[model samples]
Structures are given as C-alpha cells and as structure tokens.
Target: MQTLLKPSFTRETAFLKVKAAEDAWNRRSAILNQTLNTKMVRV
Candidate 1:
C-alpha cells in the first residue's frame, strides 16, 4: 500500500523502481532456469 497511496516525486524514481523490478524478475527467472537444468541433468 504505500506505493498505492504515494506517488513518485520524480521520473527518475519511477524509472529506478521499474529497473529494479525488471532486474529482480530477470534474476529470479535465471535462477529458476538454472535449477530446472540441474534437475534435468540429474534425471
């Protein structure tokens, strides 16, 4: 909720938030892909 209630004060802040989210998502997908590959290798 804080994000819902408070608007970003600058374009830079919004851009930073978007970039961080994208980075985190990319990292998560990469980790998941790696785990899946490892499991497949073991099988």
Candidate 2:
C-alpha cells in the first residue's frame, strides 16, 4: 500500500531530476557547439 506508492513516487522524482539534468546539459552543449562553429568559420 504505502510502500508501493513510495517506490513509484521515488522513481518519479528521480526521473524528473534526470530529465532536468539532461536538459541543462543539452542546452550547454548546444551553446558551446554553436560558439565553436562560429570560431571555426572565422579561423
């Protein structure tokens, strides 16, 4: 009952955390990649 709900809730929280982290990483990566491309073009 309560124990089963706890596991599902915990999984949901963990998934949210992972998703947020992945989104942040992807944003940073895109910015860095764009900057690198511009620099490469200039060079």
Candidate 3:
C-alpha cells in the first residue's frame, strides 16, 4: 500500500517492521493452533 507508493521508503526499518509483523503473526497462529490441538486432545 503505502510502501508501494513510497518505493524508496522501505529500506532497513520498514523491512524490519514487516518481518517482525510476519513473524509475530506466524507465532500467534502457531500458538492458537497448539491451543486448539490441546483442547481437542483433552476432549
């Protein structure tokens, strides 16, 4: 979005932000999946 418009804007910090966001999302999804699996096993 904004990054596409501002091609020169995404260098180091922007890259780090995007990477951190992606990693956080993946971790969150993995945690949720694990919780669901644990609940299923308990049942």
Candidate 4:
C-alpha cells in the first residue's frame, strides 16, 4: 500500500507525492476520454 504523506514529510518527499498524484489523475482522465470517444463513435 502507498504510504500516506504526512505533515512531517520532507520537501522532496512532498514534491514526489504531488507529482505521483498528478500522474495518476492524468492517467485516469485519458482512460475516461478514450472510453467516451469509443461510445460516441458507436452512437
């Protein structure tokens, strides 16, 4: 399981955590867009 970033985290750790979250969000968005496009094309 991913460790939760707490207030005691170092600056570098905090930055890495933020970057990871952004990457995850982008990935999910891409998947959602692809699914929507495919459904739209079929309609």
- Pick by TM-score: which candidate is best? 4
C-alpha RMSD between model 2 and the true structure: 6.1
List the lowest-lDDT window of 10 residues for candidate 3: 34-43
lDDT tens digits, residues 1-43, model 2? 3544345457778999999999999999988778533755453
lDDT of 1 by residue, 1-43 (tens): 3545656467898899899999999999987778533755454
| Pairs in clash, predicted candidate 1 | none
State in Å the error of residue 21, model 2.
0.2
Q: What is the TM-score of each candidate against the true structure?
A: 0.56, 0.58, 0.52, 0.60
Local distance difference test values of all predictions, in order: 0.79, 0.78, 0.78, 0.86
| lDDT at position 5, candidate 1 | 61
1-43 per-residue lDDT for model 4 (tens digits): 9987768888999999999999999999988778533755454
Which candidate, 2 or 4, has the higher TM-score?
Answer: 4
TM-score for predicted model 4 compared with the true structure: 0.60
User: Which candidate gets the maximum lDDT versus the true structure?
Assistant: 4
Candidates sorted on lDDT, descending:
4, 1, 2, 3
**Clashing pairs in model 4, backbone N/Cα/C closer than 3 A:** none
